[model samples]
Target: AQQQENSEKVAKAQGEQFQSLTQIASGQADIAKLQNQYSSYNIRNGMYTIVAAQSGQVVKAQKAGIGEFVKEGDMIAEIVPDDVKYAVEMFVRPLDLPLLANGQKVRFMFDGFPAIVFSGWPDVSSGTFGGEIVAIESNVSVNGKFRVLVQEDKDDRRWPRQLKIGAGAQGISLLKDVPMWYELWRNVNGFPPDYYQPASGQKNSKTSK
Candidate 1:
């Protein structure tokens, strides 16, 4: 009986040792987990300042200046990512829209550059780039055609391919509505094919008779 009692005591002591070791290991694991979580929190807090991803001119400014109240998701500025190609967006009348399509040739003339065509000169020049109508926005209405976004090739390498309108530089010089008004005004005045041209030559001679 004494021998059996001793065996029972040994078994109990072994179980107690195992439980103590398990508790110690579990406590260490919890400490490591807490430390990891604390480190991640600090890293996230350090990244709070919003910064521009790339260097470029800002093209649009929704809200800016000190003491301005900005709501969540408010557009502060637009950054034209570096090395990106750009295109001028000119809205054509709905009637003229049908004449244009994807893959059709386009001749671009910028006000900044006076030249009508690009002569492959090393210097920046105003001229047409090799481009096609990649897309057409179809929200046509009484206000005229909707916005059309165009992508230009960036091979020129004169200025950064993309330009942000409102950052570090001035915003888009003229509002887009101006062009819409011009197109509408021209339509009212009967422009291009819509203009009535008086018959000349033989027709006028016959009319005199």
Candidate 2:
């Protein structure tokens, strides 16, 4: 009888141990769930806040003002970095499109600045900044011209910091090295030298061969 009583006590102790282990496991699971909820809450809170991904100045702010409804993927602001790399874009006519390609050096004369450009040779050009063609749009732009993107040449002098966004720029892309007399002949005899400046002031890019 004593042995039987001892056996019952051992069984009872085992049952209590099992209950404690089960409770510990359940508590751990609850802790894990709570931790996940906290992380999700943090993520949801971040979505409501306007945070800049990088260190830059906000040039333009939310157009809708404060406490306005905005859907996802909407442009809230435009940021400009302290050391900004400006991109200059120009459009080329269909006839001139054959001359331009990627990696060609371009000479630029910013609208706000004065430059005495020789067009073909950039070395003798004063007050002109150097750039290179980066992108040529496969499709025609809204202006009915092929859009070309120009980036600053890292080896050349940096552009002026005071330059504003959407600033006008005149780009001369030297397509081929041809005789000066030939260029004059082409211009004189109704042969278009790649670009024609219309009075509407829409197209400003010129290419020379």
Candidate 3:
């Protein structure tokens, strides 16, 4: 009887020890979970002035000046890499939107630079450089115009190295190549040049795949 009683006491002690250890382990897990949630909140809200993932020069800062109200999620800065390729952005008339397609060749005449541009004769263009339509934003911009992105043409002259961002450039998307004499005759006859129309089964510029 004494041996049985001793064994019962031992089993009860072991059960109590197991219960205590389980409670301790559960408490530690709760602490770890809380710590992880705190860390995640700090990262999402940015504990410090946001750190850039890559090293580069900040060309512009969009922060408000001193004494100005700062808003959450406002841009902190604009960083440009050391070796950046530039592209010109131009807004197109809504009526001309249908004529532009992906990879369509364009001619550019930069403002503040002199260039005698012949729309139909891009090959003989003097100061004008070549580009191609890379992107077209259907969303309307200022004055109800659509935005188009143009990049350097690999087959033609390169853009001027001195050109800076925000510089204005007039662009013309060339379509439907024709004989030079036919263009001149059309101009002389006061005929408006024909716009490009894709035939059946051709990709639509507005919805080009």
CA RMSD for every model? Answer: 13.7, 9.2, 7.4
Whole-model lDDT, candidate 1?
Answer: 0.55
Q: Residue pairs in steric clash, candidate 3?
A: none
lDDT of each: 0.55, 0.82, 0.80
**In order, how many clashes per candidate?**
8, 0, 0
Model 2 residue 118 lDDT? 72
Candidate 1 at 145: error in angstroms? 2.8
TM-score of each: 0.46, 0.61, 0.56
What ranges in model 1 sit over 4 Å off? 1-12, 15-19, 42-77, 115-131, 146-209
lDDT of 1 by residue, 15-103 (tens): 99999999999999999999999999988788555578688767778776666777787778977665665555656667666555553
lDDT of 3 by residue, 101-174 (tens): 76777778898889986655667777887887778997999779998888899999888887877888987766
lDDT of 2 by residue, 74-114 (tens): 88888987766789989899888877777778778898798
In angstroms, give how far residue 171 of model 2 lies from its true place.
1.0
- lDDT-sorted candidate list, best first: 2, 3, 1
Q: Between the candidate structures 1 and 3, which one is better when assessed by TM-score?
A: 3
Arranged by TM-score, best first: 2, 3, 1
Better of 2 and 3 by lDDT: 2
Q: Give the total clashing residue pairs for model 1.
A: 8
Pairs that collide in candidate 2 are none
